[model samples]
Target: MRNYSGVGNTLTLTAPYDVASGGGALIGATFGVSKLALKAGQRGPFEVTGAYDLPKDNAAVAEGVRAYWDNANKVVTATANGNTPVGVFTAARSAGAATANVRLNGSF
Candidate 1:
């Protein structure tokens, strides 16, 4: 799925459009709501980044995603470059719009 929003909070499992007999899925990803906090007198802003690869295009993937580090059966290695840093979400942040700069924020 490229980009999708839920109606209310729901737990739904989405299946890939294509899965080979034994090839399985090539890529899989997921996202969820999360919370963050900022102490008093915090500066402009900070960045929260995950260790993963950014999708090269905005296709069926690259929606609400980072990479899913799945080492199926411990066969495929997903953390070979786990130390590599990906881009951070540093924009769309509310500009000083919190009593204590603490709240739950994330995309669906």
Candidate 2:
């Protein structure tokens, strides 16, 4: 393997609004987690792809299940129809857990 530019799996983009580190960000339909806290219009690294631990809905989720993003509540749910899907749940999440591991599928 040859290492050229040395760019990792993350991308830098201007924050559309204030976002905390690890918070979800939607850039032109590309959903990702903010690598660092950023103010509105500030350029920062964002993880556009890969598995990430993110906040999940109260509903219990099983491993290998597809999860949808609830834009209004900013959480991932097991429901599919009418919701924006963000990724597949790689780990089972009990209703008590606040977050779940998700393998991001990226821009549908």
Candidate 3:
């Protein structure tokens, strides 16, 4: 058997600042979600994703996360991040697996 499912996207927001003369640079970068997955036993409950941002200057890029809720809950059952850290979500190091899954509606 073979099957897979996932969702993710790259998001970016910028605001430009000025200097003295006719030269300035762009700033501001928010955490951009890189990926989300729902795979089989291939990995774990979920591989918490990270983000990679493009910077312009001293634009305090992805310093901290912007979540209304505690970010840890979403990753409580993660097995491990992945081969590569995507971005700001890159803060996500690596974790272990959650309780096994039993398709028959019983304990595994």
For candidate 1, the C-alpha RMSD (Å) to the true structure equals 17.9
Instruction: For residues 37-103, write the lDDT of model 2, one tens digit per residue.
Output: 9998999998877898998888899999997877677888898876787789998988879999988
Each prediction's TM-score versus the true structure: 0.16, 0.80, 0.15
Q: What's the ranking of the predictions by lDDT, best on top? A: 2, 1, 3
Q: What is candidate 1's lDDT per residue for 53-102, written digit by digit as tens? A: 22221222222223232223211121224322122322222223211111
Q: Which candidate wins on TM-score?
A: 2
| lDDT (Cα, 0-100) at 98 in candidate 2 | 94
Report the alpha-carbon TM-score of model 2 versus the true structure. 0.80
Alpha-carbon error at 51 in model 1, in Å?
3.6
Q: Give the TM-score of candidate 3.
A: 0.15
Report the lDDT tens digits of candidate 3 across residue range 17-54.
21122111112222222233322222112112322222
Candidate 3 Cα misplacement greater than 4 A, ranges: 1-49, 60-62, 65-108
